[model samples]
Target chain A: MNSMVEMQNVIHRYSKNTIIDKVNLSIQSGEIFGLLGPSGAGKTTLVKLIAGILKPTEGTISLKGTALRHLAQMKNYGFMAQSDALYQELTAWENLDFFASIYNLSRKRRKERIRDVLEMVDLSSFKDQPVETFSGGMKRRLSLAAALVHEPELIILDEPTVGIDPVLRRSIWEELYELKEKGVTIIVTTHVMDEAEKCDRLALIKSGKVIALDTPQKLKEKVNVTSMEEVFLHYGGETK
Target chain B: MNTFHVMKRILIQFKRDKRSVALMVVAPLLVLSLMWMVLDHDDSKLELGAVDVPETMLEQLSSDTLDIETLSSSKAEGKLEEGTLDAVLYFENKEMSLLLEGSNPNAAGAIQKELQSLREDQQNMVDVEYYHGSEDLGLFDYVGPVLIGFFVFFFVFIVGGVSFLRERTQGTLERLLATPIRRSEIVFGYLAGFGLFTIVQSLIIALFSIYILEVFMDGNFLYVLIVTILLALAALSLGTLVSAFAKNEFQMIQFIPIIIVPQVFFSGLFPTEGLGTWVQIIGDIMPLTHGAEAMRGIMLRDASFADIQWEIYILLGFTALFTTLNIFALKKHRRL
Candidate 1:
């Protein structure tokens, strides 16, 4: 598989301590790459660096062999934050509408994309409701819908399913798989073993460093573990 | 383009937060209305009870503010104790003793001011008339223009500061920074967003104070609205710029006394004419001072817009300067 994104020798610090420590990684095109780590393990910080929200303390991140600083690559990426980042005061449709404008989609395309994303999230019935009234699961799903509203080829989601129910989570995963089949590369950060199991490739990270990288089955087999949880435990060193 | 999105979110957020919405529109109007009623004097008579007043003192105490009745010494004491009379006076020749009910400060102040003004009138101090107008100026008349400036400064300072602070704390600010949207657009967007409301607010406050409350508008109505609105914009910009330094709403409110009160002191309600030269100079630096001066000039002095053009320019200058700082302030979120 060809690389769609790469982080080369990235180092980011928070005053006294480093959050992402000289890490180097590359993600293949059209695959769901999972960053598995506990909370405070720099998952959101790392994703923020990739999204160009922060300039890495040292080194660079590029998308499709082109630096994200270039207009084309920046436009081709969709980023979903760990927080919902939804304007609770606005209706679900309004939230999507406002974000869609930033992407510069034509009116016709924006409307259709909004309809598609709302339907995909199973929130079309409540599209006119204010997001402040949405349940935590609905808000998370709405955030995901906003990320996909622009239909970019590369999507980055930071802890996208934190408060989602299993049934809805499964549906969201199905949608992710469908997007992957259509050659959309995805990066998701999660500490949940079941969610990590869904990614085509997994990177086990600890204390701002990636400890292992392989396919879910391959990594588990390589670590002589039956479950993704045990494989992460093995790599994260929860055993003697 | 994305600035519109941020602005729309701001307006919607304000609408959703009913407490602030009420504060923005309702609170100022409520206080102003209270001030109007409190300041307006109807020249109504108060029942005065006198106990054994010498005939000479009774004649001197006869004024429109009082309807005096001589009571037996015991009856006068009873009336005073029962609150049947506002005051009970006892006089024996030139030695008079006055007893006043003092539970409410306003009632007490009214009695004292009336007595003082009557005494001055009797003593003949050029009748002490105001050069521009009569002494009939009411509570709203004295405080109306200053209150207008204060409301605009106060609410804009609060709403603008807190909302911008929220943007930072909520992480949406980081998301917006990640976009290609420029910093000036963010500042401009806030100006437009809050500007929309200030226009309506200024119009309402100006109309109510001048036309409804009859707070004395000697100058053009349009000039009054213009100065008030411009002040609101400057306050909004200054507030948004200050928000960059504040981490939360509490810190945002800390700016009120430091930022808003000093402006009021210099804005002319208090006598700053005799203040130390540099002390009075501090008032010149605040946008509210120029605004209040213009408002007072227009409403009280009947001055034209040209007479206050420099004031307008000074206010506009503050708006622009603070707006520049607001844009630059966004650098705290993103280096660019």
Candidate 2:
């Protein structure tokens, strides 16, 4: 399998403390990958480095066989930031239209694709609604829709469903799986135990280091655990 | 820059935030219009009262200059107190008594200046006077053109700078950066976008000041338009350039007293003759000094294109320098 992203001995530090050290990770194409960790476990920092938003102090990252020296190279990969970055005064269609224009999406294509994405996020009925009027859950789904509007090959979602209802979260994951079937690489950072099981593979991270990397079944078998919570505990080095 | 994208975005924002755009453009127009009404009130031939004046001296006074209404001393005093008569003249006992108009400073200054010049001309008989402009030009008329330029530069700079800073602090800037667009394109896009509305802004202000306010349009109106548009360019560039350094709108507003008010002090709005040497030097580097000088020269003094050409060049140079510095400043946004 071709590795979509290759990280070799990446080291990142903030201030004097080391946040990540000599970490090696390879994310391949056509898979839903999850980074599972507790808060402050450096999972967000690791994904941000792979997305090329942050450069490693030591080591290199190659994407699709090209070194990520140019930040625009990473632009082809959609990134959903932690905040819902929609303009409050702008309508949903206006926000999406601006994104489409900024990505240089063609007029005809933007129109059709905006409709498709709005429908995909269940915001089609509220196209003219200003983003300020949107609920927190709705805003998260809208941000997700913006990241997927261009239909890029790779997507990096930083805490995509924090306050979302379980039913809607399940639907979003189902949509991610559908995109995976169509050959898109997805990377998600989450602390939720059940969501960790949905990924094709996961890297259990703690303190900026990946403590475990394997399929969910293999992780459970390796630790002789029946639940992801127990797997997290096993990787976290708790005797229980 | 993709001008259409930038322009469309601004137009939408204007439509949504009509209050801000209107405040920026309309507020200046309202203040200027009030200034015009207060300053441009006409002074017809003054109905002065003269008593016991020599026939020769009284005949020598031009008919166009005064009406020469002969009234009693008591009547002249009453009219002066009521502000009906502009002045009263008496040459009894070889002592001339003059009563004056006291309401507007410009009217008093004009009358004093004209009488002084007329008195000097009378002292030199059969002498040719090589006068350039009328000695009786109103003070408002003298300062009006510079005020026009000042208003445009002042309003555009504050509005654009604060709005751009708001974009940065509100996380919209980071959102924009996440897209597949270059940093320089974003800067240029803002310039072109804001530049479009400010063109209409500049035109309305210049024309209204010249035609409606009658604020002394002496030279070619087209040249006035050219200088204004160029000055707008300078202001716009300065606005975007400074926005890079400001973290919030309040910080942007703080730049006004530092960056803008000093321009007024040295921009010919105030007399700078007695200013400290370095203060005057500071004015020389400011974009407003050039813009205000060019505007005053063109609209009030009726100076030709050649006279203001150097000012135009300096304004353009200021804008270009600010834009280049702006590109350099964007390095803070991204290393590249």
Candidate 3:
């Protein structure tokens, strides 16, 4: 199967310290790939690399067989950053329409896509309300709607469910699954182990390197552990 | 096209954020109105102490402009020190001398000017005609052109810088970069978007300064609009460029003293003709210096486009340079 993303020995540094060490990753198409790590373990940096927002200092990243060094390649990337990143003063629809226009969707298509994404995120009722009045979960949903506005082939979500309640988190995961079923590749970074288990493939990263990469069952079975927390502790302890 | 999208996003945000919009448009007008009331005072009464002046000369000098009080030199000095008197006019022997409270520059200047005119009356020299301004020109008329440009530039710089800084702090800038839009497009979008609102702001301020406050406008109104708009663009580009270095909104405010205040001092609100060579050079580099000069030339000197063309090009060049730096600055966030 062709990989949706290919990072060959990527190394990214900030000043003297390396934030992402020499690492290799291949994420398959139409699969939910997870980068699991603690905060500051370089998960956001890795996703940003794949999303074409940052350049690797010592290696290359290719997205859908094209080099990820130009802005043109980012058209396929729908990035939802850790923060909501929505314009709080604008209405939810305005934020979605802004991103839709940024992606250069046609006027008619933009309206359709915006409506669809708002409905998908269950935020259509509050579409006209300013985002500053939104609760945390509502803002997150709006941000996800904005990411989905362009109907991108690849979605990169960084810690998407940090402050969300369990019910909303489950619904978001269901939406992610729906997108995956539609042949759209997804990359998610999270510190939560349960969320990591929901991904088809996982890269357990620590301190700038991926210590383990496998399916949830394989990773748990290799360590003979019943829970993802144990699997993470098993690999994270060994690396230390 | 993506640039236009960014512009639209900014305008939409402005629509919802009424406080910021009011700050940009109404704040300057309010301040200018207050300044007009204060600086355009015509009945400025002065308190004077007559020190050993002859009774006849004291009668000659006593007018509505001067409220004369006869006192000893020591008493006169004490009253002057205590702020009850603006000046002490002493006539010892045949020569005339004046002692002015030097702390208040305006009071001192008015007294010195009045003293000189009294001396000029003694010689009876014909009153010199003003080429650019009338003898009736008030301080507001003199500083109104610069104040207009300064306020527009000031409000736009703070608002624009804080707005861009918030984008980074809120992570929207990174999200924007993750799109297919180029970095230069982002800068251009801000210029065009903020440029539109600032155009309205400039029009309101220019019309109010000239028509409402009745500031002297000797040249074409179109040129005043052109100069204020260019000044706003310079401020906009500089604001965004500086925002890259600021980690938060507070740090952005800290730039005002270093970046904005110095420009005011040299922007011809006061005379910089006798300033130090290097100080004048510092003024020369400030975008507002050129802006204020051009504004003064147009509104006060009735200068044509050719006279202020150099300033126009310099302001445009500053905008371009700051914008190019902004594009390069974004490379720190995304190399591509």
Candidate 4:
């Protein structure tokens, strides 16, 4: 497998305060890579950098062995922000169609992909309903469908399951696993311990720095802990 | 192609928002009709008391728009004081003395104009000819073009600005930037979407004002539409560019006093020529000033397209400048 994204000594600052500090990581293709940290740990910033929505103050980020520069390179990834960035006045089908068209998909392909993504998110029946009438979970599902409508190679989800219930969260995780099986690289940011456990690999981040990185089993065994929370606490305390 | 998609989504959003459509199209006509009602009326006759005035002079003053009554000097003074008479006229020692009830400036000004015209008529009766509008034109006719331009600019500013601001607050703007779409595409897309609606809006307003309300239209109706559409486009671009600085809907409303009201003062609602050069220069920089000017030129002065082409260029310039600034403003969300 090849590395989908690589960050080298990446440092980001907003005025005098550093948001991302000397971060280095490699995300493998066809893997569910998770960035686990408490809030304000620069997880969102790091993903935004990798998504090329932001420019790092120092250091470089490369995707698919090439530097992220041209806008055409943005076609490789799909981003689902913490906020469900769906147009409330538009129907679910219209929203998906819009996102797909911005990716320059043909009319027929956009219709087909909109159907597929809606089906994948189990929102096929709600396609014609306005998003304003959707529940929080349904809006989240539609947001995920928008991100996947174009069949992007890399999918970056920032706290995708925050307001979702356990049953729906399980289904979303299952969908993520299904996408990974199709060789789609997935980068997920989460603060939930169990959600972190579902990732193929985990990077424990604290105070703008990654403290530990490995699979969930290896991270637990190396820290001599049974729970992912203890492994996070051990790594976090060690960093302190 | 990406721009077309953005434009399509906006049209879809607009289709769902019927109230906004009504506000943009119908509100202007309602306000204009109200204005016409308030400004267009036949002149009221003033009540005048005459004492010891010659019969020939009294006949001259008694032509129209005045009610003359013969009374003693004391009785005339009493009538003027009691407010029953707008003015009291008498001659003493071959000189005329006038006593006026001065509480209402409009009434006082009307009496004064009657007296001044009487003096002028005594000297030599001059026939007045209009170069543009006739003497029958009311205040509504004079200001109607400016008000039309104002309504278009004002509604487009609020609606377009608030809608674009919603994108930022709702996070759809960030989502849009994350796509491979160019920033110029977003700006142009908004222009095209809102531009189409403004064309319809301009047509409806121009027709209603010219034919329905009957506010002194002389030039071709198409020129009025063209000027209004350009003005709305200028407002749309400026509103979106200004929205970049606003954080929410309330803040967008706060811009009304700063951005929208001042333009009304400069939009030829009042005469800017008597104002200082610097003040006129300030009016010159505002988009509505040129819009109102071009609108008045077309509707009142019967100006041809070539006659108002300078204003047309200035309005186009404003739209282009604000649109480019808006494209730059999107850089705050995504550097690309």
Highest TM-score scorer: 4
Q: lDDT per residue, candidate 4, A42-89, as tens digits?
A: 999999999999999999999999999999999999999999999999
Ordering by DockQ: 3, 4, 1, 2
DockQ for each candidate?
A: 0.39, 0.35, 0.84, 0.79
- lDDT at B86 for candidate 2? 75
Give the higher-lDDT candidate: 1 or 2: 1
lDDT of 1 by residue, A2-78 (tens): 89989999999888899999888999999999999988888988888888777788888888887667434556778
lDDT by residue for model 1 (B45-93), tens: 7767788877776787678877889888788777777877777777767
* Alpha carbon lDDT of each predicted model: 0.82, 0.80, 0.91, 0.93
lDDT for A95 (candidate 3): 87
Choose 1 or 3, whichever is better by lDDT: 3
- Backbone-clash count (model 4): 0
**TM-scores, one per candidate:** 0.88, 0.81, 0.94, 0.95
Model 3: residues >4 Å from true position, as ranges? B49-59, B69-83, B87-123
Native contacts recovered by model 2 = 0.25
> Model 2: per-residue lDDT, tens digit, A29-107?
8888899989888887787787776678899889898988785685577778777877767888998888778777888
Per-residue lDDT tens digits of candidate 3, residues B1-336? 878888988998888889999999999999999999999889678888988899998877766787889999999989988999998989888788888888899788887887777766766777689999788888899999999999999999999999999999998999888898899889999999999989899999999889989999899999999999999999999999999999998999999999999899999988999989998999999999999999999999999999999999999999999999999999998888
lDDT of 3 by residue, A35-65 (tens): 9998999999899888878788899889888
CAPRI-style quality class for the chain A–B interface of candidate 1: acceptable
| Model 1: residues with Cα > 4 Å off, grouped in runs | A70-73, A238-240, B9-20, B43-57, B67-131, B254-258
